[model samples]
Target: MKQISSSQLNREIIDLIQNHPEIDDFEVLAIDLSGHFYGKRYPIASLKSFASEGLAFPRSAIVVNTLGEPLEGIYYGEGDGDPDAQFSLIPGTLSVNDWGNKPRAQIMATASSGKEATFFEPRNLLKKVLQAYQTKGWHPTVAFELEFFLFSRKRDDQGLIQIVRNPKTGRPDSPTLLSNTRISDFERVIDNIIEACNQQNIETGAVSAEMGAGQFEINFNHHSDVMRAADETCLFKRTVIETAKKHGMMATFMAKPLLDQPGNGMHMHISVLDDKGENIFNAGNKPQQRLLHAIGGLLDTMPAAMSFWAPNINSYRRYSGGSSCSPVSLSWGHENRTVAFRIPLAKDGAWRVENRVPGADANPYLAMAVSLAGMLHGMNHRLDPGKPCDGSVENGDEYLPLSLSSALAISMGSEVLIDILGRDFIELYCQHRKADKVAFEQFINAREYDWYL
Candidate 1:
């Protein structure tokens, strides 16, 4: 694909609306530290201005924790003087949301401030990692398999939380078995999701019902560019949540919702290719064992990387053993679900490792960034991960943190993470997450435990 310049992006925006006609507005988004969307929408008429000058948003808007607490030095420490950044819309990612009476086009944007771009911005972070591979005459491809839950809107008599269910099944909290296969009772919502993805030109591999009640997973096809993969994952979550709300259902990407059932996860499949467009993981004369060692690197860093994978307090709940889903140890085997990484037994280009540590709640940009960092470390240091774990991983020596606090502590001391993501970024991330952890723990005291969950 050819590189798009600002003038070219502006022209494309005008031409896009002219050809599509249904698109009335465009959303320019920036992924903040929390991996949440921090952006503004503009009328199509303002496309030229937005494309050229970009939108002016408070730098503080992207630096705070979810609770809005300001990180002391991250935002203002650099001097807050109108810290504006350009947002160039990715051409192919433009899509329409038709849930409203009028359709609106949505586009993902990468933020750039002066010569030094914000590396913490998820998209930019992924772009930077991809550049590292590009410089080595290699390219990275990624696929996202995301899982999430759908909950009923109704509350209990005393105003406590409860799960919605199928009336015929007589199970109030049981999963709803909608008769419409193509379009469940949630058809309109799913349709809206499909529409948004199609409008954005994101390739949707499949949408399927998961094991848990009211749970679903959407898998996206692998893209050679890491940015496109991260962009798609970000948009997927936004589309699901927005569409679910329109249909009176709550869509949650929370890692674990119910203690007993399966928890949501975001598994990433990655592979590297050479400048000649050849799969580097493939073995013709070269042995595939080298690829296994790369998987080992990911396994070695699995514990430290958990902070990025399961960023929130609720994320660790997904790590329970009985589910046969979540990974309990750092191990990899061919097509193994019990292991942290799984090497799918497939053809040359199809061979790749699926890193299962990340929960659906993770920011795809950070997840990809950390995953690339691990792979690159393995490639550079030649770290050979031992034999893959077989059967249950409960007894396995390698284990991930049991809570967000533990994960943060490990991440804070991770030399590899600091080396790759930079000390400043790591410090900023840990500070924000540490604050979140403290707030969440304080709020969830013994008296409030049952009420909050």
Candidate 2:
């Protein structure tokens, strides 16, 4: 008899079950530092009970690297046994995955204990920074533009990654570079990706062909709630990967999947709203103190935050000038793709700043946390970001930690960053990244055999 709000209606797992009876299975997922989600699938018959109580996943899930090897001294390993943290499902994310043979649904969940958010969790870390915004009566709106490559299992004669074939021509390459016609090559899977995002309420904006043979970019609309934006961004990446697999193609979010091709990147556009719901970043012709301080904070912290932005070793390979729009310097400019942070051209209230530091492989939750925290730090410290760069930045500008190892080292000693994202997360991230680097070092590459063997 009572009408429910759209959001409340979406959260009704029981209603979802009744509506989509075909969905017998559901995937409840949570992400680690590597942006890899781990969860168990369950039959829909137990959906309601499980949704109410939530699910418990290992705390080690947060500390481990891409290798899934756990950090040695973290809370997950420091204790005699790994502790379990119950994470509740994110409302409205119960998306129906009718892509493959399995007619299943999936939902994104966040780790939390009772009413308090687990500090170590990446999603929770973003929530903490959002709390800082809430305290100051400011709202941060964010959107993600993610670029990725579509590769078939087949490789070239040189063992190089080959792009997916054109559905129309049956040719294994994109002839029209950065053309919408190029999308026709992989139209089936691309359309599937669009449909999946729409079903998940991810508000996907545009799809465009990128410089890489198989690379494409998908844009998302802005969400005023930063936490929800982060969650949707995370889910969106997973959806892209999963749906691609269903179509017999591999979608890679690796920062630099191919050495000869353009690297994939995750570019985030940010705008803050005031108490009256007005975009506070609309600085008119001149820059406002708040906006400048925000930029200054980002620049000040950009070097240390590099560890999260470029989470893997391959991430740094994308930082070169030759790699289109992959910015490496701590510079901001008006609609400048050459700079790490750019103020896009828009109407007064529509103005937004884009942080191009994050690779497609970055954990959206952690990256957004870094961006929001930098904005807060700038305001709190009243810092100043200097003039924008005239030409393309080398990203090797002074004070920037360019390498993965160096970035991790800076992250280990950064008290300010620790205060922003939490010392425990910073520590685990550093240790785990070191292990990841070490693993790569211990192994000899085919190229190494060519040169030094």
Candidate 3:
């Protein structure tokens, strides 16, 4: 029940222990720029000491790239000698993990030496962007629709992933589009996932089988707290993956797990509430200037924000095709899935824009940061997005970044993004992406020699 935002660590720790005695241990988690949560577990009794001093983690934590390799040219590496940074909890994130091996509480954290937050931390970057909206008295409501693939534990002869079979009829893999039969076939898996999500208090709205075989999409309920929405996304991924393993299958959030099959995506839906708690996006079917400005902002910064949306080399493949609604161009439309931004057809008071750009593999914190920043920036500058498109936009606008290298180049050089996400975080994120690009390029894939050799 207690929340610690400042120096009330001791008092808050006491209150936490008194309130949540069911939890024996605590998982101190901190999300870095690479979207990786790295930290250790401590006994609940040790919260008094650890909470005050803050659990220590290396500064290199933020510099880690997608490949898990440390990206150089950062201030913490050579000059600062990779010193330890203090990590403190985000207060109310403490929750009992129903899916864990034992009774344990988990909390989100940020690492910094001073009272100010570290810009390189993904959560901090998001917080910084959200502050802009807060300053204008514009509250943001957000939700996420995550698509993932479930594969059997066993791999093929060549170690390729195969979809989990439907036990009843013994169907290997059928692209059953929204069939209730498919839901019953995977009832146990779906039920267990629901149980796990319920334990964490994650409000899930809908669960349905997607276009691909054994692929499913889960939708979270819309909420006013943007940070909590992002937190649920990270926790939902961990919950789904762990629960899948328990059910004798593996769940992957990879953008493109298969070359021929559909890729996974994380779609974000957003709307702003005014001071009177009214949806600003509810300005008729075409929407008001505020909604349009938000669209303009997202479209304007999307090219630079591509790296954050599609963080890995394999992430780029999601846009290449095969997926039903994966967007490839930088176009916005009214309820059109072919474009990056979509104003979904909704009833009155439910109006919103869906950012269909981010892949399932993206760091939720960073992706939300860039998306929000673009909107806030657009509103500030009153950027006009022009008219909306009605077409599917196979190749309407300019081409988006096709590789991590190109995405990194544009992200690093984007003054608007740099201003929103901060120069320190932008520079740091791009460096890590650049390192990952070089590493991926150096290692030639086996398929390369299939034709050449």
- Report the number of clashing residue pairs per model: 2, 2, 0
> What is the Cα-based TM-score of model 2?
0.92
* Model 2 error, position 47 (Å): 1.1
Clashing pairs in 2: 328-395, 329-395
- Model 2 alpha-carbon drift over 4 Å, by segment: 1-11, 69-75, 113-117, 156-159, 175-177, 285-287
Off by over 4 Å in 1: 1-3, 20-24, 67-88, 113-117, 157-161, 166-188, 284-287, 321-324, 396-399, 442-453
- Per-candidate TM-scores read 0.89, 0.92, 0.91
Cα RMSD (angstroms) for every candidate in the order listed: 3.5, 2.9, 2.7
Rank ordering of all candidates by TM-score, starting from the highest: 2, 3, 1
lDDT of 1: 0.74
Query: Which is the winner by TM-score between candidate 2 and candidate 3?
Result: 2
Residue 391 shift from truth in candidate 1, angstroms: 2.2
Predicted model with the maximum TM-score: 2
Residue range 317-394, candidate 1, lDDT tens digits: 888633537886777877678788888876644667889879998989999899998988788788888887666555
Please report the candidate that would top lDDT against the real structure. 3
lDDT of 3 by residue, 337-420 (tens): 888899888787578889999999999988988998898878788889887789767663455787788888889989999887
